[model samples]
Target: MGGAMAVRVAAAGHTLTVFNRTRAAAEAVATRCPVDVTVAGTAREAAAAADVVVVSLADDAAARATYGGSDGLVAGLAAGAVVADTSTVAPETTRALEADVRSAGGLLADTPVSGSVSSVEGGTVLVMAGGSAEAVERAAPALESFAQRIIHLGPLGSGATMKLAVNAMVFGLNQTLAEALVLAEKSGVARELAYEVIANSAVAAPFVHYKRAAFEHPESAPVAFALDLVAKDLDLATALATQVGAPVPQVELNRRIVGDAIAAGRGAEDLSALAEHLRG
Candidate 1:
């Protein structure tokens, strides 16, 4: 996701400095960007050199490691700089990071996004940003360059919480669709035919159409969104629901299904693989 954004930013005539845990990956991204992209040695160095530092990591541990380490991004940020994170994590985690950046005289916002890789590349993703109005405004230009719709949702953690909500519904819907598809196949319908019908059906979401190929042939499904990542997102969503007074029965059930799918060695596969697993 970071790599895609960097390319888009570079294409938009913005000077982007990029950093990756793997030096070679960063170098590779730099070469592919249409415009020149400077590669920074570390997150700290990248933050130090830029006024607006954007980070999108895998999870809470990776995020904390990058932003809390001795030579972390937060430590090197300039005063009044805006540091934004696009990871989908617990709301409290975002608040904590917000406090850390604010204490260091920088602004922090949680800006989780929605849409597939194609949408991201097309710069048509919806960005749910959470922070003060001032901070959201400060990050608008960069966000606008990559996002077609940007919603500044209230304060810190709000964006992440909303993202968690969105994710729960989406992944749960996919899992339910997987079950329905499997049922259809077992009830004397061809999987391919079933997928075509669903893709054109009234209830079909854009995501369903996007994953039609994967749903029909899970064996070689492209890993646009991996099973493990969505599983982790579901776990976060479940935790949030439990914390709040919401009874998400479907989310809990879908969480177990995703866990089973991951345990069945489909962790690295596209989440549409869940249909294959369910059919099994």
Candidate 2:
């Protein structure tokens, strides 16, 4: 996802520099773009070179690691720089990171995005941005590089909150769709035909349209969103729900189903593989 976003940013004529824990991964991103992308050895080096730095790490832990150390991105940031963090983490994590960036004379926006690789490639992902209007506006050009739409939710961690809400729906839909598909198959309905009806029905969301190949041929389709990541997102969602005194019983159930699939060693499979997990 990070690599795809880099390609989109570069395609938008932004001067881009990439840094990944794995040098080869950074190199791969550079190779994908026709423009010159400087491959930096450290997060600090990359952050120092840009006024607006967009971060897309794996999770909260990775986000902390990239922004916390003495030679971190915050340390290398020029004064008044804007940092857009696109990782899906708890609101608390973003709040803490925002403080760190603010202390360093920089602005941080919790700009978690919603979309898959195709959306990134096409520069059509939805960005849920949370920050002061000034900070979010400062980061708009870079965010606009890869986002089709950007919604400024509110201050601090609002983007994370909205992202979790969106994922809660996505995960619940995934589980219900899996069950519906498996139920149809077991009840003598053809798998493809059932999917056809589902896709054409009122529930034919963008996720369903893009995920058709994965659901129809779980074994052959590339993993768009891994189950392990889905579990992680579910954990964030449930934790947020608890923090705000909200009830997410459906997400809680989806978490258990995802946990069971992970325990069975299908953690690395696509989320659509939930259908196969249910078939067994």
Candidate 3:
């Protein structure tokens, strides 16, 4: 996903210097784009050279690793540099990261995006950005190259919070859809008829429509979103719920189901693999 976003940014004519823990993967991504991307040896080197630095790590710990340390991105940021963090984490953590950037005379914008790899490649992903209006505006031209909708939600960590909220609905719906399909198939209803009915039902979401192929062919559905990532997002969601004293019984149940999916070693599979998990 980071690689794809880089391609999009470069395509938009933004000069890019990419950093990755694995140099080969970064080079592989560079090869996919016609734009010449500078390959930096260290995060500091990359952040030092760019006015707008985007960090697209997988989790909070990874985000800190990418942005922390004495020689990390924050260590070498130039004044007025805008650091865009594209990770799903706790709002408080993002705010803390923002403080680090601010101390270095730079800004941190928490930009958690939603959509599949295709959406990213096609420059149609929804970006939930959080930070000062000025910083978001400064990053807008670059963000517009990769996102269809750029929403500046609020101060630091708003994007992360919004992403968690959105994932709750997304994963919950996915789990429910899987269970519905499992129930229908086991109760003598033809799988085709069940899908046909559900696809046309009022409860059907665009996501359900998109995963129709996965529903029919769980073994072959392209992995747009993996189950392990779903579990991560759910973990963030549950934590957020607890912090706010909100009860999310359904989300809690879905989290356990995702844990089951992970325990079955389906973590690397497409999230639609839940149906296959449920079938077993």
Candidate 4:
């Protein structure tokens, strides 16, 4: 996601300094970007001289490690600089980071993204942001370069909450579709025929259509979103529900199914591989 966002930003003629856990990966992404790009040695170095520093790491632990300590982004960001996080982390983490950044004389915003790699590459991702109105306005133009829809959900943590809600629904619908596809296969229906029937019916949804090609030709290509990442997202979503006192039995069940898929060595496979689990 970070790589995709960086590509969009650079393609729009913005200079970029990137930092990655792997130098090779950072350089690789930089080579594809259109502007002058520098690969920083650490997160703090990446944030130090930038007007707006965007962090798009994996989770809370990674985000905290990058910005919380003495050698982190919090220590290096200039006063009045904006620290925007695009990670799908806990809302509490977002709130805490916002407070911390403000204490350090910088602004913060939680702006999580929705849509797949294709959507991101096409600059059509939906951005759900949570921050003060002024901050949202300040970030709008750059965000708009990459997002087709940018919604200011509410204050500090609302974006993270909204992202979790979106992921939960996505996981539930994806699991249902995986099961339905497997059932159709077992009934000897051609996979393409099954997908066509569903796509023509009211039961069809964006998720179903998105995974249609994968369901039709299971072994045809590499998976874009791996199973392990989906499992991690589901776990985060489940935790979010618990924090909000929302009961999500079906989400929990889907989490377990995802966990099982990962445990069965499908972690690196595309999530559409969940159809294999349903077949068993």
RMSD, each candidate, Å?
A: 1.4, 1.0, 1.8, 1.7
**1 versus 2: better lDDT goes to:** 2
Model 3, poorest ten-residue lDDT window? 202-211
Q: List the residue pairs that clash in candidate 4.
A: none
Q: Which should have the higher TM-score, number 1 or number 2?
A: 2
The TM-score, computed over Cα atoms with residue i paired to residue i, of candidate 3 is: 0.93
Best candidate according to TM-score: 2
- What's the lDDT of the predicted structure labeled candidate 1? 0.85
lDDT of 3 by residue, 118-156 (tens): 778988889999999988998888888889999999988
Q: How many clashes in each structure?
A: 0, 0, 0, 0
Candidate 2, which segments miss by more than 4 Å at Cα? none
- lDDT of candidate 2 over 12-113, digit per residue (tens): 899999999888999989999979889999999999998999999888999999998976899889898999999999999999998888998999999999
Error of 2 at 177 (Å): 1.1
| Candidate 2 lDDT trough over 10 residues, lowest sum | 68-77
Give the C-alpha lDDT of model 2: 0.92
**Which tens-of-lDDT digit does each residue in 144-166 have in candidate 4?**
76899989999989898898889
Error of 4 at 160 (Å): 0.3
Q: Name the top lDDT candidate.
A: 2
Candidate 3, which segments miss by more than 4 Å at Cα?
A: 188-193
